[model samples]
Target: MQEFAKKPTAHRHPLPHGTLTLTTNASSMVMCAVLEQDTDDCCQLLAFFGKKLTSVEQKYSAFDRELLEVHRTIHHFHHMLEGRQFVMQRDHQPLVRSFAKTADAWSAQQQHHLSAIAEHSCTIKHLKVEPLPTSEEYRYLFTIINRSTRWPKAQPIWQQKAESCMKALIGWVSRHGVPYIITSSSWGVNFMSTLWNSLADNLGAKIIHTTAYSPEANGIIKRLHRSLKASLTARFQGGIWRKELPLVLLGLKTSPHTALNISPAEALYGQSLTLPADTFQHTMSPASPSDNRKAFERIMPAKATYHIARKVYIPNELQNAEYAFIWVDAHRIPPHSPDYLGS
Candidate 1:
């Protein structure tokens, strides 16, 4: 056998310019997509809009309209995703600030939708929009996340009142388990701090808030929202938002989680939950020895040996009804005739 000599290995080259890096800043809006490894046939859509709407009507006038639009868009987007995953990013600071001061009077339906969205993991960050240096274009700075494997389905809740926001958050925590942590931008720090102060007393859970303007910290959740939005948009075309919201949510619950390779419902429940279908049926066999024995006993009759013994004595009594017995000594002399012996 001939031995081969080792050759010198070449050094690896550094990443080229414009190459994407995983450790991007989190203070801006990020758009993440969720796609299957095998095929792109099934796609979901999610986007985080962090634009600040300014109006001349009043200081708080833009609050209600902008909030309503956000809710409407989210509802519409969910329908579009249908059965896929997506992510969306939002400016953490302003988003939380808006919620802290303006979200106390939301309607019941709005609260429900908001709470549902808030259940997911998210990050807070500052998104600064500036004008282009020389052109008429504007510079939009935001964050984007892809493939948030651990966290999924994040929702943004903006309220003007801190107390109200805390109440709503507590309700969400009660319904759904607590998240790993709470993240927000610089503006959100105060609100989160106040919120966390009462977490143990009100929510019964510890809430650790992340640094301001660093959304990449909660990348998983942001990516999930993007995938969810994309799927919703593609699935529901020109459908009524209110009518399709529930269906979209159901699709998410039933869809399989990529990381765990199981549906959320199954992971949470330990067993797969059944959906409504006419053809669906289940047949279970007895599992334990006692169960099997009980099943067999149900099909057999009870034995009655005591009743049989009593029945046999009745026949013997009827056959010997006319018979009578008399005792006689061994020294009897007359044995020829029965009547003479007796006399």
Candidate 2:
């Protein structure tokens, strides 16, 4: 087979002049891209990138794979191609639809891949590499949301290292007040790191670990994470998630909750946010603001009164009793037996 060059390698840095072009390809297993610039005589090489698809990625359709390949390439060369207009050369024609302004339904992953490199000024063209792909494809996500206000903050980290996590957490604390408690799952090395624990300790914050494989322990954060991702995926057409994050957060913070019947921002700050898209005037009423602190204090006496009247599990002596009765579910009980069983 004839080769482009036996030992020729692309320059690691930016080219001074000529048109910059990114050519990409992807198979089931692996994907590759070459960045080249049109010089006076020949197209001089700038850089190259390639990666093996993960098992999850390998299962994706051809269009998805090609789309992923394109996203990775733009992200890999984001620093060089960020501000300037450039050309993207790919084989799969299907991938171009993402760049087009259309109302067609896109997969969550597809929306995400497009959002990453959406900020860059680039144009996509057909190039036969065997096949094609979007943006700042973030590898790690650091998300924070207030338990009381339900206000959220999500940061995209390039690496899953502890330092990045620490930085993200510290930045959040600096902007918002230091949290009294920090809770997270055990999946991330960033969260499980010694540095993370130390940071929490130093900040006088208690670290709470969720039950392994159970999302319910931290369901609020998980739900917010899902919604945040969905909002970013749906509304954003281009640009890195970093830019989109604040916009999404704004909508989340200001949007009224169905249960509370008030916006989190209004609940916390006692006012509605002034936004570009807000058309109607919102009048705040002092009696109806869903401030949790005030509402809890106002309702505490009623809660105590109701519980006292019912006398349900009131001031139980279970701790002191040597042989206390335990409440068993119907499935755990005998074929025909009392609902409560001896422990």
Candidate 3:
């Protein structure tokens, strides 16, 4: 830290040529921000900010709270960001649409926040990432989600029984807010547990248990498990699989789901995520065009093995086209049920 600050050409003052990317994430109780400069290989950290929310502040709706975090974090480094027209990355979605909307739609409090941030940032490129805590210690990943938006999250728990399930459920509900209903498999520990009953009684959430071994009963999470497994398989080739879970979740949230045209991040908060492709200045060194496409294909949510489908490799010429054609086999895809993969 001392050496970087001592360097005359370092980011003590904002640089003229590089782009700044400010990424922020808000938990139930606090918010954090990181400012970085875009380098060839990765982002270089410039500054970081963190704050605990007040009692009243913590009660703000998720979207509003995330926006407040952004507004304050930008002002904290206003001098550096002013006139820079940098990028923004948040964990929630509403901040994107809120900024795009006219002031007329915002409440007085939101207006106040915007006024404070107006000077520091005008142009913004938004991205989102939901926090995914691993089950390294617990050895189990209990998944939960906002079913309406398909905004899924996971937590590591020690076991699949009543007490462990209760803690994992609480962890997600506390951070993401409560769900009106929870659908799960008819596992003996979960369905028969008195602890589970007590939890449902207190949270006022209705529990719907599916028939034994019928995954279709809770298809949403089943699909998520598939996507998670697919992403995990790609990263397992090398690197810590535990740490990669967060990025895997980010890919699922940011990538457009087959059921919904929009990504889960967008569906929940009207926000978009900046994908790796968005910031990659150049392709991987010594990799061919086909190899690069195949590599990126690994990040895609659906795997070719999951279904009998054709994978299309889009040409560079059509990268930015309004739309490109996808061929679907008539025998496999039913009428009005067309399906195809893209890379």
Candidate 4:
């Protein structure tokens, strides 16, 4: 019981002889799970999660909901169970046979979620007993945690900010689509405004504000800004920093972020931008047809692997096409109006 209560630490080394155990339960509009690894009759709890179902999800039957709990728990611990087979213990007996059979009668949403979980190698075991004490404790903790937390009441991220900031955020959303959340300072310019109400009414974004004067709250962004300023001062010296800021920002955006394993631009756009260094490689003489063929053969397998990993699909026609025209949005074109470019 003490071991089950202790939070699991990441395994420094893979367990050569152990079985990953997952137990899940669902009731009404809530679900929870208890993850453990068993070796030599000893079981160690790995992690647990509890979540309230969405309105659409609440419509699902008890059986489907139980399967959803299984799917969600497997997804949460995928890293530990990726290549290895694991045992899934569910309180619901019907799911054991249901999942074994074809998913012809499953709802599209359930099917979609189940398909992702199915890719993981695992066997489902139906528990003959009632819900475990750990699972029940998790549910109690989840409910209490959900109630005690100050959940943001508004539907949108920009729900409570000044008109200027609201307009800036709206413009950002218009261009980039809705962000997962908007972080801002708890200042008069952000907190006291009617535009925030409008934002909540229009676009629902999760807005989080930092404590005033708390540098530690947004330390990463602050540190990066300081670094950028230092770099600009060193590179530009006595020149106007504003004049060179865009180029510096572009360089920073294209450069890899140590924590993310990708550039800021790539994180936002899902692809890396073509910088000057990319063009530098193309300046050399073109390869002969035979050399190109050899290069293609060498790179084809890796390219195929990359596409599969990224879940990117290219049509046969597009892949074989000699020329491809990527349509750019009119608003993104320089000088918005064609005549403004002095044409």
Candidate 5:
């Protein structure tokens, strides 16, 4: 009798619900923005666009190329916004202004695209750009995680010149909604710190910081990086990595998420997504039974059961582990068999 009850519960675990996290890296920022919304929820991506030139001479030579890339990113964002709503978060503020400047600078065809985005009648909010800490040890990737979806996305913009990266971030947030919280590693430049102060004075959004070195507090973003790298490695062969970024990104967006037990597309759109024919082909017959359709529709698994199982399994799995910790809100816990404050 007990086994039968457990069986039913176990089979229904892993449904996609609750908070969503959006994680992004620089190479795949466009794809990240495309996946930032669901039926009733909002998904956001914070991105850093890299600048190619290292010196003033190179900047002049690469001017056209840099402008084109920036235009492309803006165009992509416009394309993703079709009939959807989203919030953008960023570590810098200038990118937002650049898009507006670029829009003003466009030729006819490009102007048309920019005009349409302007006509979309969307709202763009700019978070005040923050300065990084003076300490060199604390800089790492920046991330934006949605409070509701528990989806986190990150971009490593450290090597890129800070100003351009900040601009991209600002542009992204201006288009998307304001974020509830921004998480980052301690040290490096405290980019969000300045922004938070301004936001508190202006927008009234609270800026909270997590404990130092306790990235698990920012687990959603960390997990996204791990998953993205793993997915990229699995799908691409040696040369494919550099050549087929678009396809790899499409796969990431469409792939099933373990936490949500559904593809990111489904979580945001409230419907099954159609994959490109080149990437996926339908195997079912045209006259396949309705039962099969129902099976496909059931993307979300039972949440309560999954949470119970996760709680029971995670602690034992972490036993005797060194340097492991758990983060809840502002607090961090060292590895141990201990109950969470609220849970």
Candidate 6:
């Protein structure tokens, strides 16, 4: 838990004789930045900052998070490097060349970070990273996909790295057919041109960005998350949450939903999941209890109505006959009336 003594301030200070560098790295949960003065042999730290990301920030793509890391570093050390030229180092290649190349598809937050960096003319460098792990190590592990649901593991990856997300998504698509649409927040990864273009061309599916701060727009997924959390908490404690996550997910998928009137498995596969309880007795699936009165309303005939016509007479002669008819209204001109006009 080593701490740096020099804190960033608005006051000016004498420029360093040598080059000053800002190196930053960002992950799903945290961002770390280190400001140092480069010497002949080694680098001396001027300031160091590490901050935890919020829930919304955690969903940002790798490129956007890296850009955010650079922006925060520059703002924190504004006084020290006001007029002096410095260098920016990041591990994400897209971010390293973001200013050099046009980023028309960059998110709002990424554009803001790029604008902040443009205020200070600095050179960008990319950090060389080791090759990430492939799906080979995970292959021997989850065999339940073949035996049970025919779906990928429903739990988050252990030691998840940057490339793991894309790999997992590919695996899912291979097992299940292409989905029609994907809805997610405006995270940097969701906007990746390479990832989306392939999806559009191959699957004819597009990603839809959810409105900010509105969880209700994705209520079903949120409800599923809560259900999984409650199920996991009931069965496991503390460190065992990760271990039993798959079991809970299976139960959730097999259980029936009240609104859909069927389990997720049945909805997807068009058949009910078979548990270990009973066998080939040919049990009949119960019909959904629908009210006959409501169902019959669509086909029922409209209520029958009878129409009656009233007769009226006038004191006039018919055109073809030599007969005249006299009109009398006994109901209106009552017999007791003193003066009643008759035609």
Q: Which candidate is the best by TM-score?
A: 2
Q: Per-residue alpha-carbon lDDT of model 2 for 60-121, expressed as tens digits?
A: 98889998898888888887887788898877877875588576588888888887758777
Q: What are the per-residue Cα lDDT tens digits for candidate 6 across 1-343? A: 1244355443223336868888888866798887877778766677778999998887776776777778887888898878888888877887766788864986677778788789896888887854223342331121113112222245355443324455555666787756666554444453444655565457677767655545555444555555765785677654445566667777876786654445657555656567655475688776554643443333222222223233446435555666544443234545666443533
Clashes of each: 53, 10, 2, 4, 40, 1
What residue runs in model 3 are displaced by over 4 Å at the alpha carbon? 1-135, 237-239, 276-343
Poorly placed runs, candidate 2 (over 4 Å): 1-138, 278-343
**Residues 216-306, model 5: lDDT tens digits:** 5555566676766676566556433434445655566677776777766555555555776745764755545776577457644324212
Tens digits of per-residue lDDT for model 1, 1-343:
1233355333233222211111112212222222111223422222333333334312333334433444444554454433333233343344445444554777665576466545433222344543222212212112211122222332232333455456555555665566444443334434545554676445445444444444555545455556666665655554433344446555665667655565555455544456665247676664798865654443222221121112223455656677544344233656652432221
Q: Rank the candidates by TM-score, best first.
A: 2, 3, 5, 6, 1, 4
lDDT to native, each model = 0.41, 0.74, 0.72, 0.60, 0.46, 0.61
Q: Which ten residues in a row have the lowest lDDT in candidate 4?
A: 139-148
Reference-based lDDT, residue 323, model 6? 50
Q: lDDT (0-100) at residue 21 of candidate 4?
A: 81
Q: Which candidate is the best by lDDT?
A: 2
Off by over 4 Å in 1: 1-164, 176-196, 235-240, 276-343
Candidate order by lDDT, decreasing, is 2, 3, 6, 4, 5, 1
> How do all models score by TM-score?
0.34, 0.44, 0.41, 0.34, 0.36, 0.36
Of 1 and 2, which scores higher on TM-score? 2
Q: Write model 4 residue lDDT over 61-139, tens digit each, in one string.
A: 7777887788887778788788998888876878887767864887787788778878988888888853212221121
